[model samples]
Target: MIKLISKTALLSVFVAFSMMKSQSVKEILNQEGSFRKDTIFSIKSDSKETYLPVTIIKGKEKGSVFTIVAGIHGYEYPPIVAVQELLNEIRPENIKGSLIIIPIANVESFQKRTPFINPLDGKNLNTAFPGSSNGTPTDQIAHLITKEIIPNSTIFLDIHGGDASEDLLPFVCYYNRKDIPENTKKAHDLSLKSGIQYVVSYSYTLTPTEPAKYAFKEATQQGITALSIEAGKLGTVQKDNVDLIKTAVYNMLENSGNSVKRKSKMVNQKSIVLLNQQDYIRVPEDGIFYSELKSGDKVKKNQILGYITDKFGNKKHDIVSQTNGIILYKVGTPPVNKGETLFCIGYNE
Candidate 1:
């Protein structure tokens, strides 16, 4: 009898261990109503030493498929926090379509607290889109996202921020294509309703080196709605901004059935300027930059925006505006250089 009892006890222990393992994995996966939550896939380093996680939540109802991607640059923390908060609040019972939230796209960079390039492959994941299956570490991840994730999405929201090196105003960027489709417009409008302070319609000619250029362009080609949201400063998480982003996501989900409301009127007037472009000005030479102007400050042509000086106490350059417009951005650091962008001036043509 003692031998029989021992065997039964061992069998019970085995069953308990199995149950615990099943529950642990199940916690990572969930399904409710029409919504299905799955990790989908993961990207690992060449040696398989590191892996980045990606999650997808599909709503059962036949509505729309929106993908929210954050942490493209690991140092940008606001988007990550915002996405996590969103995931916690969203319910499958209420959702009509699918929501794929990849809260941390670059886990390695994030873990190392780096910006832009993945430290492993020295490649910017954002730029290497529609990537090759046999490409480098970053490229393979990009390929996975573009080929496996993006194609299945009907709408895409790429969350971003300036970086640990700089501070940027919050804004939404959309391609200014004359033939933009209705779905694209819907996405843009919904983004604006998220209460972002600025909505900037940008053209391809404006940003020549944007890493997400291919992703945005591809979304446009597929007739899928895609927009980018720029939030708090890089590397740090701002609670207020995260709250704002979360609020925006909730607003988007709630308002998807209704027509997106545009709070700001479309202004033909330029309020922000990109340097080396249409009407923006560049620093003439290297020196100590002293700016009398702040962001949003209006300036006239030839107005002394700032001055640059050499280390030897010699005034090397005088930064001036080329047109009458508002200042969109200015250097926050002390040292300034020639040909380096000093300020952005927005002017009415």
Candidate 2:
């Protein structure tokens, strides 16, 4: 009888242990650290390709949802590299909020390695906003971003570079409107922490075309803090700029309490701020432009900002500023057309 009782006790203890193990296993399986990757949109081609690859890193803890988008223009390669770097560095354990990264928004443009305007439709993906369901390929992609992506995001960062022939100064563009809400301000402040050199206050009236129709403006309208970052020259990937961008992104995530701090300083608070309220000096006739002032030089109103000369060195026009401000930019090449912008001056007001 004693032996039988001992045997029964051992059996009961074993069963209890097994039950406990099973419960623990189930709990582990249901835990939040399980990261998942999915394709939000599939390309509609004969090959049935997947463009605009998005990677979502859902954190174990509950926090804000941040969306980082790049490659809005196919030729802009630096932004793509920056996004990829951000993806590879982010870890699920360190993330408090969800991070959704769309590394290449214009997949068709990217694949072609040329800036595509969709000859059949004459559409630029950057300008197509709130895209249509049954519209062109670019339009549909834009729609997906507006409906599926932007709505859920609490903060957004749209990355880009200069176009194929231009080299843009590293800057962050934010709309400066009195109607901007508090949440948008918060996100904008965080964006300043990214340590870029310049910040352009965007206006709603600037982009009247398609892509601008549904851009950072839409995000701001939804009360999401959004900023557009310009990194390097378009079509070419610069390693230094990419590294800087990666550092800035990491800093933003860390500052937002989404990850751990690896760097003490992420932004240059003393960076130059250029206001876009100045008038542009237009060339009166077709001529070669010779600038008398540099981009950062200050000048007075009616000053000889530059001169336009003909092919035989005949002065045709005098480029003058309308207000006292700094010369922000000048024509890179010569032989400009009449009424073409020769210089831009930012006022001191």
lDDT by residue for model 2 over 87-180, one digit each (tens)? 7767777777677788888876776776635432457877788677556667766766776677767787888876564434566666654565
Candidate 1, run of 10 with poorest lDDT? 17-26
What are the per-residue Cα lDDT tens digits for candidate 1 across 185-257? 7866776666565665555432323335356555655556777787777368889778767766666665664
For residue 282, model 1's alpha carbon misses the true position, in angstroms, by 6.1
Cα error, residue 338 of model 2, in Å, equals 8.6
- Tell me which residue pairs clash in candidate 2: 126-211, 127-210, 127-211, 128-211, 195-267
TM-score of 2: 0.73
Report the Cα lDDT for candidate 2.
0.66
Superposed Cα RMSD, model 1 = 8.9
Q: In model 1, what lDDT does residue 200 have?
A: 59
